[model samples]
Target: MHEMSIAEGILDVALDTLRQHDASVIHSVQLDLGLMSGVEPDSLLFCWEAVTKGTAAEGSRIEINTIPIEGKCLDCDKTFPVENYKFICPYCDSHFVQTIGGRELQVTSMDID
Candidate 1:
């Protein structure tokens, strides 16, 4: 799965940051993963465990903050959560809607020791 590669990327960043701060161990990694990002949390966690073996990040916690899909209607100028992947505007039933958020996939913070 692609999560393996993703996990490797995360480890790379964590190690780079550890070197920058001169830390000996990493306690945790926080990520902002959105609902529409299409990345499975469980799979990512499993891959993380595999990729971190014998590394400084081994046994570290991974905190995933789920972000909801949000959209804005151009017709009514109203913003609301996009339920069930529906792009229709709730206020005006308009098809002209712009997605405002929920595609995030990034590491926000790390706890190092």
Candidate 2:
């Protein structure tokens, strides 16, 4: 599905990096995946393996760091995890909670030979 496209994009970035650094192969690709990024890790991994066939990143590893949803309470001035998709602040039961983290989908780094 969309994971295939995402995987392809990742490969493109890795290849571009490889060429820029004049590296022979990509050893690994690191990614920051947040809880609300809506990207499936399993599907992404499967697509990654399929798309990397015969390429410079053929056997490269995909390292995903999962980030949890965090929110900061404007009323209580406290930060906590947003559970069960509830935006309410746990400290003050306030609805004015702002999301501080999560919802991330970015390539952080790559390891090359």
Candidate 3:
């Protein structure tokens, strides 16, 4: 699964940071994953733990902040929740809309020492 690669990449970055900062241990890693990011939190966590192995984050925790699917309707000029993969405007029932959020997959920060 892609979550495995994503988890590996995240761990690569975290491990590199730990080495650079001379961190003694990593307490946790927090991720800001959106509804449309297409990444599974459980799968990512599982992969994270599996890849950690003997690394500094071997026993670290992963906290996911799930963002809802929210977008702006271009036709209706209103903000509404988006369902599934359709980008329709809820108010005007138009299929054209601008997504404001809910497609994020970034590492905001982490707890380390």
Candidate 4:
């Protein structure tokens, strides 16, 4: 799965950060994962467990904060949460909607020891 590559990328970043900070252990890694990021959390976690073996981040906890999809209707300027991949406006029933958020996939912080 592509999650293996994603996990490898995360581990690379984590290891780089650890080296930069001169840290020996990683307690946890926090991430902001959006619902529309197209990355499965379970698969990423499984890949992480495999990739981080014998490394500084081995056994480190992964904390993910899920971001819900939000959109703004262009016709009515109504902002609402999107459900089930539907981008229509809830108030005015407009199909012209622009995504405002929920496409993020970034590492926010890491707890080091």
lDDT of 1 by residue, 6-67 (tens): 99999999999999999989889999998988889999999999999999999998899999
Positional deviation of residue 41's Cα in model 4 after best superposition, in angstroms: 0.8
Scored by CA lDDT, what does every candidate get? 0.94, 0.92, 0.86, 0.91
The predictions' CA RMSDs to the true structure, in order, are 1.2, 1.5, 1.9, 1.2
| Candidate 2 ranges with C-alpha deviation above 4 Å | 74-77
TM-score of each: 0.93, 0.89, 0.85, 0.92
Question: Comparing 2 and 4 by lDDT, which wins?
Answer: 2
Q: Distance from true position, residue 60, model 1, in Å? A: 0.7
- What TM-score does structure 2 among the candidates reach? 0.89
Candidate 1 segments whose C-alpha is farther than 4 A from its true place: none
Candidate 1 or 2, higher TM-score? 1
The local distance difference test score of model 2 is 0.92
TM-score of 4: 0.92
Better of 1 and 4 by lDDT: 1
lDDT per residue for candidate 3 within 1-113, as digits (tens), equals 99999988888888778888988687898889999898988899999989888988889998999988888887778998787868888678897788888988877788889
**Model 3 weakest 10-residue run by lDDT:** 82-91
Q: Could you tell me the TM-score of candidate 3?
A: 0.85
RMSD versus native structure for model 1: 1.2
The RMSD (Cα, Å) of candidate 3 is: 1.9
List residue ranges in candidate 3 displaced over 4 A: 83-86
